[model samples]
Target: MSKSSVYSWRIDPVLKQDLEQAARTEQTSIAQLLEQIVQDWLYKKSSPDDEEVQQRLHEAASQTFGAFRSRDSKGSEKVRERVRAKLRQKRATQRPD
Candidate 1:
């Protein structure tokens, strides 16, 4: 004869309440519900199609963020305002020239 194994985990109060409500509605135990979720997760994780999508997402993120680039702040807000005002004045003068 073989023996069954048991495991334990701590869940948040709100999550536990929600699970209990769902289990009651489905006429199932929390353990069974959790087992079904884990089985589905394992199946999806082992699928090769999901792995390719995950890799593409990682590559896209790296490209969008400029691949680990650092930005240096050469001018403060006051300096930026002054520079912008000067540029605007220069453009206005050139328009009349």
Candidate 2:
């Protein structure tokens, strides 16, 4: 197991109430919700602008081939294999020439 650090902070009551309500709606604790929001904010703040290139590629591939509509297991397996192969090829092509 990894060690963890604990930090404490304060926020306005109105803001805290809103966050608490959202956390309840999401079925999570206020601490967890705050942690998630902070982490997301920090990630967006720290990430490089060009990181969206890879993100967009991944989203495009997922949107194109992520879901299988087939009920047949064999057909699904074939589709998975084909999509996996295409993804591999695409990744290979994306590598430095």
Candidate 3:
């Protein structure tokens, strides 16, 4: 266990009541809930900016782009044609002679 210290501050009675209710609902003590809230806020504050996120997404897409491409140059059109053909074959097989 780590060392702990007590800190007190004034808050509106209604807000205190809401905090208590929330802590009870979460099955945690008010101190623990407050600690978790502070930790989450710090984590979010340290997250990457929008440009960094976009750069990361672009890098990932570049790495995986055309990874599943078919031999044909028009892979998407070929895939659609193959799917339609399979569906037609299935429907024909299900029909009575």
Candidate 4:
């Protein structure tokens, strides 16, 4: 255990009530809850290059990558043909100038 110093500041009544409720739910004092919250925030702020963060980001990207599908499995191969067909349809719908 380390020596702790007193810190105080004013906050909104509603926010203070919410914090008190959270502390009660966690079975902790408001000061201890605040200390844990501040410690967690500081840990995250200080570890931008942490491996756990990188692994989470990689997992998210891997899950989302190529998740969307077209009716045709070979859609990538037909992009140019699709664009040409759409352009022809648009031109036919337009009045000639």
Candidate 5:
């Protein structure tokens, strides 16, 4: 491991208690647990160009929008139509001078 540096971060008491319990359950120190957690988060955040991340993002966007073939969207058409209708009705009620 590289030389450890002093990086102090403050967390809430309840979360701290939970972390401590998790550390105890894992037979590790709080520092080790936090280090592992932070490392994992860093790995995920920094892997935007990774193949797995790219594939997952593409899959999610495709699932959300792939079926949108017409002028109206597929999944959210009802909500969009309702909002547009409400907006038009509201506009019609306005006084245009």
Candidate 6:
């Protein structure tokens, strides 16, 4: 578990009402909504200036590939081999060379 800090602050009632409505519509508590909003804001603020956009952007493909691996031996290699096998099967069916 990670440590968290609590702080007190005030916002306009109108804004708070809007946030509450949005939170309700999203089926989440206001606290979780606010936490997620703050986390998202902080992440965007910390990101590169060139990354400021409404569309969600992912990291470089090479950087993300093989990020999650199984507990088994040669996990990444196994995944690659499976993908290759599927491609080979598809091509064999399609071209029959």
TM-score of each: 0.46, 0.44, 0.50, 0.49, 0.48, 0.48
TM-score leaderboard ranking: 3, 4, 5, 6, 1, 2
Q: Return the TM-score for candidate 3, rounded to 2 decimals.
A: 0.50
Q: Write candidate 3's Cα lDDT for 32-62 as tens digits.
A: 9999998899998899878999999999889
> How much lDDT does each candidate structure score?
0.82, 0.84, 0.90, 0.91, 0.86, 0.81
lDDT of candidate 1 over 50-83, digit per residue (tens): 7798998999887777433336454553678878
Question: Model 6 segments beyond 4 Å from truth?
Answer: 1-4, 51-97
For each candidate, how many residue pairs have backbone atoms clashing (under 3 Å)? 0, 0, 0, 0, 0, 0
Mark the regions of model 5 whose C-alpha exceeds 4 Å error after superposition: 49-97
Instruction: Flag the better candidate by TM-score, 4 or 5.
Output: 4
Q: Residues 1-97, candidate 2, lDDT per residue (tens digit)?
A: 3529888788899988898899999999987887889989999889866778789888888877756557676885487789999999999999997
Model 6 Cα lDDT, one tens digit per residue, 1-91: 3648887699999999999999999999998898899999999888866644323354544455565545787876588889999999998
Residue range with the least summed lDDT across 10 consecutive positions in model 1: 66-75
**Candidate 5: deviation at residue 3, Å?**
3.0
lDDT of 2: 0.84
lDDT of 5: 0.86
Q: Which of the predicted structures, 2 or 5, would earn the higher TM-score when compared with the native?
A: 5
For every candidate in turn, the CA RMSD to the true structure comes to 12.1, 17.4, 9.3, 15.4, 17.2, 16.0
In TM-score terms, candidate 6 sits at 0.48
Q: In model 2, what lDDT does residue 85 have?
A: 92
The digit string of per-residue lDDT tens for model 5 on 1-97 reads 9856898888999999999999999999998999899999999888675888789998988877744355765537488878999999999889595
